[model samples]
Every structure is written in structure tokens, then in C-alpha cells.
Target: MTPFTSRIYLLRHGEIVEQDVLAGGTDLLLSDVGFSQLSQACKYLTDVELVQSSTLKRCSEFATQFSHNHQIPLLLTDDIREFNFGDWDGRKYDELWELTHSPSIGDFWQSPWLVTPPCGENMADFYQRVFLWWQRLLMNIVNNHTHKQLVITHAGVIKQLLGIICELPKESNQQNMFAVGYGKFVCVEIYIDNMGKAWPKIVF
Candidate 1:
């Protein structure tokens, strides 16, 4: 077996106007500042061969525009959508805090895996789905000899991917949190061995 190198650029969408509102899975578009942020960051992208994004407009809007501008093939999938807040989708955190009165909201921030929002996606299921999508993405790039691929997605998705690549513990410990900010990106390089095993290295 021959070894190869592939890069995946994990991009978090830009700032949204509704930052205060918990907008998970709400289909909110980017703010003007958000668009401007992404536009400035686009200068760093070079030699990108493929582009992918969440089906949500906030992510897909920028991905579509960037892919079209660069003339790269773009794929929109829901696999990378943010963790569904469910009933708490549009509510503000302070309101939920007052209603619950258990500091569950605060606890959730510290240990999301241990605390799930009402009717929201549990950490286990969210991890499973996102990891499944990530594996498929890696295999696709390796088989196709794709050198560089950009993925526009949510912060939760990015953090989970980072945890997987970094071999972080499954527990929701605040110290272990890997946060990716809006309009920012993390690059990982996939390394294939002679036996066809693939490992990832955080490049940028």
C-alpha cells in the first residue's frame, strides 16, 4: 500500500447577528460582520481542491460563495450541523437559567456530555453521527487523492473533530474543551500508512 497526505480545513462560520440567542439548528444567516470576517479569512485559502459545508444557511452561504469564487466542487450536507438545542433552540440562556434554576445551563457549559438540554441531542449520539461523517470524508479524500479540502461547519462539530483527532477523553471536562471560534479554521493532515491505516495530525 502506498501512503499519501490529505488536508481538511475545518472552518467555523462567521459571527451571527443573533449571538445572544441560542440559535442551534435555527437556520440563521450570517451578520454583515460575519461575512466580512470570512471574506478576510479567504485570503489564507490556496490550492483548495474541494469544499464542503453544513446544509444550514449560515455555513452553506459562505461555503457556496467561496466555492463558486474559487471554482471548487462544493458539497452541502447536514452531517456537520450544530447540536440541536431542540425546545431551547431560540430561547436565550439567561431565560433558561431563570426557568430551570438548577444552574443546569451553566453545568452544561462546563460538561456538555454530562448535561443535555431539553429534547436536545445527547453527546453520545452527536459524537457518533459527526464521527461517522468525518470517517466518510477522510476516506473520500484519500481515495480521490484530494490534497486540500475546506469544510464549513459549526463550532460543536469542529470541537468534536478536534477531540477525536487529539484523542481527548470522552468525559465533558472543561479543561478538555477544544473550542473553535467563528470564521476561524483548523487544518488537519491525514497520513496513510503502508498498511492503509490513517492517522491525523493537526497542521494549523
Candidate 2:
């Protein structure tokens, strides 16, 4: 029997314009600070291989810089995009808070995992999409046994991945689950033994 090993570097994209604004799927570019963050992160990860990022501009732009610095190709995938806030898109927190008194808004906040936003996906559905992408990477490990892969994506996607790796409850503490800072990274090692059972070991 053969053993396989894979390492994943999960990176959150840098700060963006109007973070408090629910600009889901709005395609906003990164701010100046975001550029600096990307440069610093690239300097830190000088040896990472296989760079990939969400297709959105904010994520892809920073990924491009890292890819150039590391000399790795950048692949874009939609599965790692930010959560879609639907009717709440482009609105600030204060604006949304004003409307939170409505029953529909209340329900959306109370059970975001189960309740779909008007014309948008719920947290579960969004996680499913992210999992699909991760599944593809696992398949690559099974076939080619690649050692290291870097994924640059939105904060929400990173949080969902953490939830899966840690086996936390579906609606676990949001603060702890998604606290990845701008341009920061977390590393996970997936170890597969002779029987092909994979265990994820996280290294912060």
C-alpha cells in the first residue's frame, strides 16, 4: 500500500473597498492597502507552489502579484467566491440595520446557514460549492500526489474551509471560524495512509 501527502495553503485576499458594504458579487477592486498586503504576503511565502484564486477581481488581482513573485501559474475558479448577499448587495451595515426590523431580514440573520437570502444562496449552499472545489484538489492528490497547493480566495471561503477541516458545528462561533486577517494564511496537511483514509492536520 502507498501513502500520499498533500499540503494546502489557504490565503485570504487583502482588504477591499467598503468591506462593511454587502457588495456580494459586485466585483470591486482592491484598495491601496490591499496591494501592500499582497506584496508582504508574497514576500512571506517565497516557496509556495501552484497558486490559485477566486475569479473575482479583488482576489484575482492580489493573486496575480503573488503568482508573478513566486513564478507560479494562477488559476481562477468561481467555486471560491464571496457569499452572495442578494438584495442586500452594495448596502452598508447601517443601511441593512435600518431594515433589520423586518421579519424577513430577522430570519436571514438568525439562521443564515439554512435560510437563503432573497435570490441568493444560504451558507450551506455556499459551502457546498466550496467543497466541490476542494474535492477536485483531493482528486488531484489521489492521482498525481502533488505535495503543496496554494489557494487564494475570499474570507468567507476560507472560513468555510476551516469549518470543514475543524469539524466545527455548521453554525459555530463566527468570530473564531472566520478570523483570518487580510493577506494572512493558514496551512493544513492532509495525510493519507495505506488504507487511504485522510486526516487533516492544521498548522497555524
- In angstroms, give how far residue 156 of model 1 lies from its true place: 0.7
User: Which stretches of model 1 miss by more than 4 angstroms?
Assistant: 101-103, 174-176
What does the lDDT read for residue 145 in candidate 2?
Answer: 69
Worst 10 residues of 1 by lDDT: 169-178
For residue 109, give model 2's deviation from the true position in Å: 2.7
Give the per-residue Cα lDDT of candidate 2 at 148.
Answer: 83
Judged by lDDT against the true structure, how good is candidate 2? 0.77
Which candidate number would show the highest TM-score if scored against the true structure?
1
- Per-candidate TM equals 0.91, 0.87
RMSD after Cα superposition, model 1: 2.0
Candidate 2 Cα outliers beyond 4 Å, as residue runs: 100-106, 171-176
lDDT values of the candidates? 0.83, 0.77
Top-lDDT candidate index:
1
